[model samples]
Target: MDPVVHFELPCNDRERIARFFEQAFGWEVQMLGPEMGNYVVVTTAEPSAPPPAPPHAVPGCINGGFFTKTPDMPAQFPGIVIAVQDIRASMKKVTAAGGQVLGEPMMIPTVGDYVAFLDTEGNRSSMLQPLMPQQ
Candidate 1:
């Protein structure tokens, strides 16, 4: 199963949203620069710790981010991102399963190729095809 590995919260004011989360939940928010779309990364737990093994493990302390709201984007609400092994195959599956794939995937430097989609219920979600490490 594809697990939700990340999340995103859209906000009109990036700094304000970051401050609110920091004050309310004590989450660490790092605002990225223009080259990175000014996205804010919220760290809810220790980044160095590995996720617990499955079957015996329940998800806990997953980190997320806040993105600047854009008028042109559809389903601009809080969304979860699922990590996929193959983006092209996943995109095909999304359409076959009655989900609407929003747009072409874009490369995120040192991160992955990412894209968003709207599920059958109209809820927006994202998927990431992580960049493989170079040998």
Candidate 2:
């Protein structure tokens, strides 16, 4: 992939979050796995649209949903993150957009560069750039 173009949010209730996105932005999601237990890919449902269509995905647009892990299986889950091309550039925009940086940007060996930030509404999320491939 060129970069991370997708994002998913962990929710206590998949259906609720799904519905929120649906009603909020008119996103049609296809649920996978048994009884809505798998991933939900967001898509558009306009009849005039082409098949295998991609939804208008972005902030204030469509979003994915995932079931939250129980306390007993805390180790099995992780929070979702937003991908960015340049972590440093993203941090500047994030701050200018009325968000506060939670911590300094630092690199994780063999992993990526990242930093956490809180939106003006106090919602927390991280902007990250995956490590460059070795030559």
> Which candidate wins on TM-score?
1
lDDT of 2 by residue, 45-122 (tens): 343335333332233443334554457432223334576788888888988999887778778445478666777976
Estimate the overall C-alpha local distance difference test score of candidate 2. 0.60
- TM-score of each model, paired residue for residue: 0.88, 0.42
Query: lDDT per residue, candidate 1, 14-120, as tens digits?
Result: 99999998999888989899999899988776655345322112355467899998878788999999889999999999999999999999998777899999999
Candidate 2 Cα misplacement greater than 4 A, ranges: 1-79
Q: What's the lDDT for residue 105 in model 1? A: 97
- Candidate 2 weakest lDDT stretch, 10 residues: 51-60
The predictions' CA RMSDs to the true structure, in order, are 3.9, 8.8
Stretches of candidate 1 exceeding 4 Å from the true structure: 48-59, 133-135
Candidate 1 to truth, TM: 0.88
